[model samples]
Target: MSGSEDLLELAVETAREAGRMLVDKRPVDGPDVVQTKSSPTDVVTQMDRAAERLIVERIRAARPDDAFLGEEGGTSAGVSGVRWVIDPIDGTVNYLYDLPDWAVSIAAEVDGVAVAGVVEMPRRGETCTALRGGGALLRSATGARDLQVNAAVPLGQALVATGFGYAAERRARQAEVLTGVLPRVRDIRRGGSCCVDMCSLAAGRVDAYYERGVQAWDVAAGSLIVEEAGGLVGGLHGAPAGPEITIAAGPGTFEALHDLLAPLDPARD
Candidate 1:
């Protein structure tokens, strides 16, 4: 297999491994297994640590020289040829609550540009994959199939997905923007996971998704999936998404959403 093919295979395998661990560990009766990370609301659990270890170990074994950046474990040095970004569990809060919206996200960056990605929703048995030049895929037990964004809805009449930031100040800003946007759009949802939110947008389940105070690992995989699926993924200003934040929308709705969010001035208002 080619280099991209190899990365794709590893991403899918590692994600599935993590997903299995998450699905198998739910409690029948007891308090959830949770602990504070950065804060009380910023939660982590045994499954998160185990999943990150599994993903890191697999990638290290397969490509010993490739760099790694994960949500739980922070960053590690590696050769410059390739870097793997992993989010072992994207929606830990939901997962702890026994919600079905969590996912394992993985992406490969070549020379700092994402070339391939995989987002696996364990409970739903859905795996969304994408390559830089190749199109996107929605995989399930039924079969593997191509995916694309739907552009039928206008910007004002479309549903949008978003999430709150971990910090109080950032969350306040997000609320401010929501105040401006809610009345103008069809609807808005806070789905608890930026990775899954972006994938849902890519799959045309929602018209757009934008959020501030997100890490690169949260959206790296999903952003590429959106772009490869014929959607636009970028910053709130409609520029290329970076390590800072993400703003993604379908072709039909991106421009208007960008305009609506510009006043927030994520950098300086």
Candidate 2:
């Protein structure tokens, strides 16, 4: 297998293992299995911990010298060759509420660029994977199929997806951008999961997606999937993606949407 192929296989395995753990142990009722991270509103749960442990363990076993950065557990440094970025459960709140939109996201970054990625939605039985120069895939028990974003959406008629940030100040800014764009778009959806939102854009379920104050793990895997699927991934200001924020959309609508969001200015506003 090629290098990308090997990374893709590892990503698929890690994501599926994490997804299985989440599906089997997700909290359905009672008080949520919750713990605070950066703040009270930024929560983690038993499912998140279990899934992260599984993914970290698997990646460590496969490549013991590589570093890891995970949502629930924080970071571990290692050799500089490869870094695995993992968000074991991308929608902890949704999962805790018995919602089916959460995912297990994993990405292998080589020299700071994600080369292989996987996002596994256990409840949906869908595993989306992408290799840097290859393409994206939507795999399930049903079958595996190549994936791509829609190329025909017009700026005025596009459907968009987004999420709210945990911080009140950031949420206020995001709301302002939403208010500006909501009236011009065909529709807007707040699905509570960044990974799923990007995947939806990749699969043509939505035409655009944007968010602020997201961690690397939340968007790393999904961003690559969107790009490999023939979409454009960037920051809200139309800059290249970094470790903390993301904005992505179909080819036809990305520029227009970027222009509309430029006034919000995530860096200075």
Clashing pairs in 1: none
Backbone clashes for every candidate come to 0, 0
Candidate 1, residues 152-187, lDDT tens digits: the string is 467678898988866677667768778988988899
In model 2, the number of clashes is 0
Q: TM-score for every candidate vs. truth?
A: 0.93, 0.93
Question: Model 1 off-target regions past 4 Å?
Answer: 29-35, 266-269
Model 2: residues with Cα > 4 Å off, grouped in runs: 28-32, 236-238, 243-245, 266-269
Q: Tens digits of per-residue lDDT for model 2 on 1-269?
A: 98778888998987887788677665447236568865668887766777788888888888898899998875799885899999988988888777889999999999888999999999888989999989999988989988889875776789889888777787777787788889988999999999999899988899998887778899999999999999998875546775445779877688888887776565432
